[model samples]
Target: MRNAMWMQGVEWLAAAASDPQACKREWERGAGTVLLEAGRHWDVVSVPRQLGLLALDILWYDPLRTPGPTLVDSAAHRVGFFVPPDPAGNWAGADIRRASKGSWVAVPPPYRSAGSVEWIVPPDGSGTLHPPLTLELALRQANKTLAVLAPVSAD
Candidate 1:
């Protein structure tokens, strides 16, 4: 159910990406432009570790979906980190990685923190840090993030 709606929204985004005027309209709408919204269930479990750090296993699910994919569907075999949002509600420490397969990659949040405190290997190799966000830059960053991360991470 939710995947269908999300796919629809993605299709709409694709269409909007194609049309300059629609893109302009959406751009003008700015931060309020929510392409899609669905109910998400998350579990953040903390496990104590060495070095005065705790490992967190974050899992996510969508109860609304009937028999489709759910994001964060499984318990992590290892711990994960929690990422906080910036003032603009955008992730602050996003970076791009060049995959060994010759593709550009974007690491997910929590791992995208400002400093060097990663507990796990990032999605791609070490990603190139993203710059500050303007509206246009935010859109581009989102497109790239979705393009890279969704295929690999989205269920």
Candidate 2:
């Protein structure tokens, strides 16, 4: 279930990347622009780590398609981070061995946390968009994505 959320996020991000403008932007910059939104934005923060940091904005929304990923066209909106790379350094991409570590964040008045943490890893040696972003983090990451995204269990 949780994995499905993240997986849908990825798929949505990928679809957005298909836009030449967004694709070129991702190629040029480590962090690309995505259209992830919830019905309302709960809060926003940075998921930090050594490798890098990414922004995760809690949206007042849930993935449109779960148990299978599909972005909700009507979710709220907030900017989330995906990595902690230099805003000045060469943006991360294919052939980049260095993987970024991610943290989990909770939004709003929730005393504790809600979502999960992750390490976003690109494919082993490919980033041409020919291959999807591959995660080399924990089985948890894969499992989470699988649960939310739905394709992981297909095989």
Candidate 3:
């Protein structure tokens, strides 16, 4: 039952695709990933991998907050977090990238984790997205933590 619930959540996410049936078919046929438009049901916020990891940790540890789906692209050294749309458009940071209305994001199947991109935190099937304010705060804290842990040296 638990596994079924997880798949249901994945299906909910796939429904965001332009062609939901086609998207599911791709995953069924062993496609590594599928492209989905952003800003309809949700938006994506991508950040440097290092900062993202830190932010993820911080979010997870917080008792009052629960982060939504999160993805990581190992090759690109970036991480993407799913959040509610439009409101996060103005979020700014040193290396943060927001995928809103016109942007397309490549999403791997819920079972795929060996490719260049994989989910660090998959969707829970509850349509729960990261609260923008909470996410911003976590990212800010992560940025500060990263700066202190690995200060750049001047040549």
Candidate 4:
């Protein structure tokens, strides 16, 4: 049941990546950073060229989803969610942790951490634009979309 719901999140994330105008801004310091907003979530996809790495930060708001206690902060409880990575590579290769926390009763934090979603893609805009029906495929395609959206440089 949880996995099915997660697929919904993937679909939503992909739709956000498909929009050309969804890009809101570029970071002054980050070379390949781009901000994307769609629906109720804000995603920051970053490509650090120097490090040859790509990362995505998605802030989702859904009062209907409740994360497990060990997945988030102790104070966080209720409808909010903070998904930890899956060590078994079930979700994407990364897993959620003890420090991760969320609360439906309160607002989520304003910061992103290593625990956030991570993936890789080519710099060219050669990714599948349509939303993937599965989580793993969605992660791959979303990373590809990020690669296309990420700035080549500070220019």
78-124 per-residue lDDT for model 3 (tens digits): 99999988864347879798999999999987666647999888887
Top TM-score prediction, candidate number: 3
Give the range of the ten consecutive residues with the poorest summed lDDT in model 3. 84-93
CA lDDT of each prediction against the hidden true structure:
0.26, 0.25, 0.85, 0.26
Cα lDDT over the full model 1: 0.26
Stretches of model 4 off by over 4 angstroms after superposition: 1-87, 90-133
TM-score of each: 0.17, 0.17, 0.92, 0.21
User: Which parts of model 3 are misplaced by more than 4 Å?
Assistant: 88-90, 152-155
Question: For candidate 2, lDDT tens digit of each residue in 24-85?
Answer: 34434533233322222111122123111211111112254111111111123222232222
lDDT of 2: 0.25
In order of lDDT, best first, we have 3, 4, 1, 2
Which ten residues in a row are the worst by lDDT in model 1?
51-60
Candidate 2 Cα misplacement greater than 4 A, ranges: 19-155
Quick one: best lDDT, which candidate? 3
- After TM-score superposition, the amount by which residue 72's alpha carbon in candidate 3 deviates from its true location, in angstroms, is 0.5
Residue-wise C-alpha lDDT for candidate 1, range 1-155, written one tens digit per residue: 54555344334332323353554354344322222111111111112221012111111122431211111211222222222112132332223211122221111222122222222422221121222232224334444544565546565
User: Candidate 4's C-alpha lDDT?
Assistant: 0.26
